[model samples]
Each structure stands twice: as structure tokens, then as C-alpha cells.
Target: MPKSKITETLLNSTVSKYRNLLKFCYFLMVFVVISCGNDTKSKVSADTNENATTETETEAPATTSSKTILFYGDSITAGYGLDDTNDAFPGIIQFKIDSLDLNYEVVNSGLSGETSAGGKSRIDWILNQDIDIFVLELGANDGLRGLPITETKANLQAIIDAVKAKSPSTKIVLAGMQLPPNMGQAYTTQFKAVFSDLASENKIAFIPFILKDVGGVKELNQSDGIHPTVEGHRIVANTVWEVLGPVLNSEL
Candidate 1:
């Protein structure tokens, strides 16, 4: 063989081998890039699915199906001086409902310094929702303000009538309140009797003396001797629950 021909053959063979090596390197690089892209997409998809599942698990349960119990009243019913609203009677009532797995939602519509007249005006707006049990605890402010008994009674009757008119099937629970002897026997007696009269006349459920043993007790009441302490509210919860529990069971 000629030397030139042999050298040319060797050179060509070397060039072809180097070109093949470069092509193989390019193929390897493309494979790595494609694999990394697919891996990144898989990780993102898995993360998205995991996040969705976590959100669903932590979401709050819906309350649309629950029956609502509306607690309508003044500061005492509002849990005036309590640390948290949950520490109040209405909240305690809710805790009981949750514990018993009752299908009831307690709405604390108590306003501080609210009078029966105030409640009368707000009754339409408050009764706007679906109320299963309407717990009326008003007129305490009216009595405290030395408001006329007849006016207070009329206001309370109007509120009750409004609740009845809005939700006719709603069970009415009237919470009777009393004033101190400072308010005088005649007026206080009439104030106390007003609730009884309304309950009797309307044939509704009644909770006489909603405050019961909690009123005037130094420890049970706040320093103002008006609002109840946490412990006091606990007793009040029991007082209300006594009548409310039965109404709930029978109504259901």
C-alpha cells in the first residue's frame, strides 16, 4: 500500500471516531435535560396535590345545616365583663351543644345597655335569620333605668310578637329578670310579673329569674355588680340550659 493512502485512511478513521464521540456527548446532554424537566414537573405536581389535601383537612366544617338558637337581651346576656365571648352564657350554651352533638347554633344577640325599646327596633333585623329557638332576655335595662313597667311589658310583647311573626314555628323562651330592692317593691314586683304574664298569655316557655343565685353575689358578679363573672355565667348557662334543653329535644 502507498504511505500517503495509508495515512489518509488513518486520519479519516480518527476524525470519524471524534465526530461520533461529540454526537454521543450531545445525545447524553439532551437526555439529562429532558429527564430533569420531567422530574421537576413530577415534583411540582406532587407538591400541588399535597397542598390541596392539607387545605381540605384543615378547613372548617360547614354550619349551614344547623338549627339556630338566638339569645336576645341586654348586657347580662351579652357577657359584659367576661374575658372572651365564649366564656359567657351563650358561648357556654354553645359548648354544651357541641358536646352533645346537637344540631343547634347559638347566636348571642345581646347588646350592652340595650333596652326593650332598643330590642323592639332591632327585632325585625335580628329575626331576619332562621331562628329555631328565640330566647328573650330583655327589660333588665328598662327596669334599671326606672322605665315604666307598662312600657317595658309592651316593648317585650312587641319583640316576642315580632319573633312569632317572623318565624312562627320558633319556640320562644322568655328569660325573666328582677331589680334590686332599691328599685322599690311595687315596681320590681310588677317587673318580675311581666315575664310570667307574657309567657302565660303567649303560651311560651319561660325561665323565671334568669340570674337566679348569681345576682348580687359579690364573686359571681363583676365589680360593677351588674354583669356576671365567668363562674357566674356558668351557673347562668345551667339555668338557661335547664329550660332550653327540653325545648330543643321536644322541638326536634
Candidate 2:
């Protein structure tokens, strides 16, 4: 064989090997770029998933359901002697709830001068209700009649228990009352403590004194002094609304 022909063959072989190595290197560089791109895309996808979950969690709190409340009380709650339906606390509360767009209603279960025994007797009628919240407002009549404090406490406690047993999910708010000074401090204290104790023992909610800062005010009281006037009802509604508003999550 000619030397020149042999040298030419060798050079051709080396060139072919070098070309193949160059192509392999080019393929590796492209593979690395594709791998880095995929890694970046995966990280972006994971970040997007985390952001979506966080957004859903943040929105959950705004979608909670609002609660309903029932107004259960006596003449004072009944808007006794107020000649108009809107003059009652139920009416007032209804208006407030409406303004705030709360899913609630105020069931006015008021009776005039009803004693605790009467309340006990009529309890089933009251208990047989689909109430989410109960404003336990009784015992004023019992206090007026000089009824036994123990009796009043028992009746109120029974009502509270019944509400819990029946509804189980219903929240109780004891609208507390205080006796007139003429009743004497000892009896007054006992009468007042009836509600306080019942509410405390049951681990339920309470309104320190429903008529606080408004009960005996002449302008706020009705002609009877015991009952509230139209203006008085407004005050009472606001008083009851103050505690009840937060419990029911009702606006205004």
C-alpha cells in the first residue's frame, strides 16, 4: 500500500472520532439545559400549589355561618304597655340584626307578671322551640311576688338546662335583673344572685344586670316605674344588644 494513502486513512479515522466526540458533548450540554429548565418549572409548580392552598385557607374564615338568637323574657322584654310592636326589644334587635345582615331572629316569648311557678308550668311550651340562643329573662315577677329565691333559681336553671338538653348547640344569655331598693338589700342581693349563680354554675353566658344604669331612671321607666317606656325599651334593647350582639355575631 502507498504511505500517502495509509496516512490519509488514519487522518480520516481521527477526524471521524473527533466529530463523534463533539456531537456527544453538544448533546450533554443540551441535556443539562433541559434538566435545569425542568427543575425550575417543578419549583414554580410547587410554589403555585402552596399559594393556592394559602389562599383557600385565608378565605375560609370569611365564610363562616352566622347564628340565630331567640328573645325569651317577661313584660319588660315583651315591650309591655308600649302600644307598638317596633317598640319592643325583639323589634329593636331585629332591626339591628337586619342592618348587620346577620342570620338571626328574635322570638319574643314574654308574659306579663308571670311568676317562676308559672314559668315552670309553662316551660314546656317555651322549651319546645327551635332556638339557637335564649335570653333567660324571668324572675322579676318572682321577685315582685316575694317568691323564694331558691324557687326562682330552680326554674331559671331548669329552663337553661332544658334549652341545652334540647338544642345542645344553643347559647344561653341570662338577662339579669335586680330588685328594687324597697325590697331590702339582703333580699335584693339574693334575688340578683339567683341569675348570677345559675349562669355561673351552668358555664353559660350572662348579662350582669339587664337593666343596669336604666332600670329606675324616671325618663327611662314607664308610668308604672317597674315597666319601661318607649324610650326605655330603646335603652333596654341597646343594653341587651350590647352583650347579645357579640354572642350572636349580629351586626349593630
Best by TM-score: 1
TM-score of 2: 0.70
State the lDDT of candidate 1 residue by residue for 1-252, as single tens digits: 999999999999999999999999999999999999999999999999999999988896865688899999888888887779889999999999999989899999999999999999999898778999999999998998999999999999999888888878999999999899999999989989999999999999999999999999999988998889999999999999999999999977
Total clashes for model 1: 0
Query: What lDDT is reached at residue 213 by model 1?
Result: 90
lDDT of each: 0.93, 0.82
lDDT, candidate 1, residue 79?
85
Cα deviation of 231 in candidate 1 (Å)? 0.1
Encode model 2's per-residue lDDT on 1-252: one tens digit a residue.
899999999999999999999999999999999999999999999999999999989887666554557677788877888889678877988988889777776777887777667766777887776778888788898888788888888888778777888888878888888988898889999888887788889987788888877888988887888887877777888888788878775333
Model 1 TM: 0.75
Q: Which 10-residue window in model 2 sums to the lowest lDDT?
A: 61-70
How close to the true structure is residue 244 of candidate 2, measured as C-alpha lDDT? 83
TM-score of each: 0.75, 0.70
* Runs in model 1 lying further than 4 Å from the true structure: 1-64
